[model samples]
Target: MRAYLIAAVLLALAIPVRGQAYMTDSGRAEFDSRVPLHTFTGTSDVLVGRISLPDSTVDFYLDLETLDTGIGKRDKDMKKTLETDTYPFAEFFGKLVSPFDPAGGTQPAVVRGTFTIHGHSQALEVTGTLEPTDDGLRLQAAWELNLDDYEIKPPKLLVMKVDPVQQMRISALLLPESESGT
Candidate 1:
């Protein structure tokens, strides 16, 4: 009986203790770029992301081909300009800088991470809100990025060109990995 108890304690100690990990494959990411004469908006609903609760680590990625700007020609041009053929995906890996309480209501948080686009990576800090849901957590964030910083040249039309800076927004609902069904 003594040996059994000792073995049980050792087995329990060997078990890994980990925070809940949540993931979502249908998240959304959007970008808006406007000029005086033209306004361009692109959206991708194929974003995949994971968030580790308690630890406050998060990662997300979306295929460049998933972006739709409503115009075929414009989408093709943008894809070519971004060199999507070479860099297939845009990804972000970050950690929450502010303390998060999962049981608490919506809380403001800052996520510091690296944003990789078109084969270039840049350090970025984004302020967003985090809220607990029945499944897991919901995150909403908005930030601006400059095209020049990523070595992406602004696309031009006949008389107007897209703004050098673009507004980006992300909304994701992540369910616990165990409940994500894949």
Candidate 2:
């Protein structure tokens, strides 16, 4: 019993922390949208993701409610437009289109999979770079998203309209499940 307890404690303490962030909130996700004369970006630090080795599978999710555009009204309007109450998360699960040598330096990774948002799913292919870190792997990926494809109606700000086209990006440091403590 003591041995088991000590092992668990050691594993819990083995994980490294950057600043005050942990595996769950260490990642970043952002989206940029333009509407004629206006361009705004929404960002969140609560991106959660993982990359499976050997199989080369990648998965990530962001809580829609966590996104902030610096304006409170805009965030609420955006959530309403996204129907986030019904679908609170945007998620992607896909297999890497190419082989990645973990031993090598940073490499480009292509993934094709389904993206779900606003209760709708659409097929998408994205490209990103992956680099190995001492604690885990760091992955950064971006792709263009058509809100209409996800059945998201762009919100209107007074007389201004939000663009249906959104540019999305995510950067995450994914530790092994054992080290992640969850």
Which pairs of residues clash in candidate 1, taking residues 3 or more apart in a chain or in different chains?
Answer: none
Relative to the unseen true structure, what is the C-alpha lDDT of residue 101 in candidate 2, on a scale of 0 to 100?
Answer: 79
Residue range 1-182, candidate 2, lDDT tens digits? 99999998877665432211224346899999897798999999998876666456667789999999999998998898888888999999888887787688889988988889888888889999977778777888899999878878775658677678899999988776667865
| lDDT tens per residue, model 1, 1-182 | 99999999877754422337788999999999887877878999989998876567889999989999999988998899999999999999999888888799999989999999989999999999999888788989999989889999856766667788999999998888878874
Query: TM-scores of the models, in the given order?
Result: 0.88, 0.83
Q: How many backbone clashes does candidate 1 have?
A: 0
Candidate 1, residue 51: lDDT: 83
What TM-score does prediction 1 earn?
0.88
